[model samples]
Target chain A: AQSVAQPEDQVNVAEGNPLTVKCTYSVSGNPYLFWYVQYPNRGLQFLLKYITGDNLVKGSYGFEAEFNKSQTSFHLKKPSALVSDSALYFCAVTPGTYKYIFGTGTRLKVLA
Target chain B: DAGVTQSPTHLIKTRGQHVTLRCSPISGHKSVSWYQQVLGQGPQFIFQYYEKEERGRGNFPDRFSARQFPNYSSELNVNALLLGDSALYLCASSASRQAFSYEQYFGPGTRLTVT
Candidate 1:
């Protein structure tokens, strides 16, 4: 079965510091990984997706993800964090099943 | 262009009751997908329809069903609802004709609460 794992339930980082939300996926075929952010009471907003391109994929709101095939990881990273960047983040993988399997989610807290 | 849209921002129901949720895809989008997002969890795939035909379905029970209209609008119907069914229902749309696999645009989602 294809699945994704978000190791951290919550991540705490001071504003202006780098932030990382870790994710690892398991898939039989090529992994179609993506990142999404969700604010309270709001729907998910797509951040970035790693289809078949450069390992480092840049996305909205100054976000980027590194797709590591060896580690089976697609970690979301930001050079500098902001208070507004604090939200729930999810990692998903779309495999051959034509369905998406999402991670449990990581709550990113950017302290100001 | 307008993004995907869903109706009934919030709803409250009880066990054994039936509920219907609606979604309108973006103009020119022929594919629509439904997801269930419980609190503190990720969204789970429910169904996907293209050109008003079912393309894929998740592991959800028969109590959860959906259909797409000729206009590309879709409806999700859940019967004999349980507290477990309480969650935010999200609708996503994509242009399937161009690429079979592409990122989907999501809507604000409908929050459902069961008592």
Candidate 2:
């Protein structure tokens, strides 16, 4: 079985400061990782994904994630945070299949 | 192109009642999947259908069932709904061969409330 974990229930950061949302995974085979963001009363928006190659995957809205195989982690990051960037972040993983196991989300609050 | 679209954006039902949620996938897509997102929780995979065939199912019980039409549109049906079933039901669609990935495009979701 494959699973994902977002250790922090919530994260707070100041505007213009860098932000990081942590994620880890457990899979029997090579993993495909993804990050999604959800705002108030909306569905998820894909941020980035780590399928293979290029440990640093850049995605929509000035966000990026590093795929660390050894650490079994794929952490979403932004160089600078914006108030609009505040949303719920989710980490999902699939083990060479269509079954996606998602983390229990981490709410991000970017204080203006 | 339009993203995945779900109908009855908001629905209210009571326990013991059955409900149906619908989804229309993006054009040119052949796969659709259903997920349940409870408040303060990540989306949970429920079902996946391709080419109008059921492909995969999650840990959900038999009361939860779904099907995909020829056009790749899908419907999820829940029998004997419980309060625990109250959540945002999301539908996602992906191309048959997205190549090296199963990237899914999500719908705005149908918010189902069981009172």
Candidate 3:
């Protein structure tokens, strides 16, 4: 029932350019949205999350996300793209429970 | 200062065999959770244990079971593994008592390949 969707399977951006990885969530009650990055053969690393506060939330590695309640979106954004930033990104939502539902994932490639 | 840790970075098993994956949570974390991440897909929740108590479970089958110890370390046991059971098993830890909604820290994960 509660889930997050990443419509884009892959996103490409040139190095030093801004990048955006879109995520929209469907859930009842308030949505706890989170973004995660996974490198090849490694576990997922937390990027950021939006709970109940300000719509614009900043996170590690110069990453930030905007939580739009009206559009049911929580898009991950970066002012500049680096080649190292290229990885699998996932959007997740939890209904104030220990269980989390994740999206299929989006692969971002930063071209030089 | 260490992050979460999982044992046996890689494993190869046969269908119908059983496997046990282990995880050690970060220091002071009271909650441990398990997830299954198939290639090209997001991690799916498998189980969550808090203070050695089962807090939540995912849509996995009964063949999947897990438990946490007093030290906050945990293990996930899967029986009668099928080809579909092959996945990257991830373990995450959090301090549920500290916040309204806690962000989880993940381990490197154990890659299981079943033939």
Candidate 4:
């Protein structure tokens, strides 16, 4: 069985400041992790994925995530936050299976 | 190319009524999946189809069913609708079922309201 946990229900950040959204997962085999963002009334947009490369994976819109095997964590990070970045972020893990287990999602609010 | 597309942006139905939602995968994509997201919750997997065959199904009741067309388009049919069945039906597509690690593109979900 695979599961994801995002402990925080919401995250508040200031524009132009660094931001971080926490995520962790539990799976049997090696996990394939991904990050997605969903705006109001829109579909989820892919941010980044960790397959089998570096621990730090870079993605679109100046987003990145660090995959830690020992910690079973894949936390999303950004150097500078923009008001446009405000949205609901989800972390997902697929253990080489057809189904994807997603986190509860974290609402990011960037104050300008 | 346009991303995954779903029809009927919104719908309303009464109890015991049946509803059908449609989805068109991205061009050249052979895999399509459906998910249901209730208010204040993350999306839950419903069904996955590849090559016009059922690949995986979630813990849904028999009232929920789906099929894929030869063109890789898919439809999700729900019978005996209940108030609990009201949710956002999302469609996602990937290149292949084997590529489970690949990111899936999602369509603007159809919001279903059961009255």
Question: A2-68 in candidate 1: lDDT tens per residue?
Answer: 7899999999999999999999999988888889999988888889998897999999999999999
TM-score of chain A of 4: 0.98
Q: How do the residues B1-115 of candidate 4 rate in per-residue lDDT, one tens digit apiece?
A: 9999999999999999999999999999999999998878888989999999999988899999999999999999999999999999999999878646888999999999999
Write one digit per residue (lDDT tens) for candidate 2, span A1-112.
5789999999999999999999999999888899989888888888889989999999999999999999999999999999999989999998877688999999999999
Docking class of 4: medium
The residue pairs that clash in candidate 4, if any, are none
**DockQ of predicted model 1:** 0.59
Please report, as a residue range, the 10-residue window in candidate 3 chain A with the lowest summed lDDT: A91-100
Clashes of each: 0, 0, 0, 0
Q: lDDT per model, in order?
A: 0.91, 0.91, 0.93, 0.94
| Position A37, candidate 2: lDDT | 90
Q: Give interface RMSD (Å), model 2.
A: 2.0
Tens-digit lDDT track of model 4 for A48-106: 99999799999999999999999999999999999999999999888888988888899
Candidate 2 versus the native: TM-score? Answer: 0.97
DockQ (Cα-based) per candidate? Answer: 0.59, 0.61, 0.69, 0.76
Q: How displaced is residue B106 in candidate 3, in Å?
A: 0.4
The segments of candidate 1 whose C-alpha lies over 4 angstroms from its true place after superposition are: B97-100
What TM-score against the true fold does each predicted structure earn? 0.96, 0.97, 0.97, 0.98
Tell me the docking grade of candidate 2.
Answer: medium
- Model 2, chain B only, scores a TM-score of 0.95
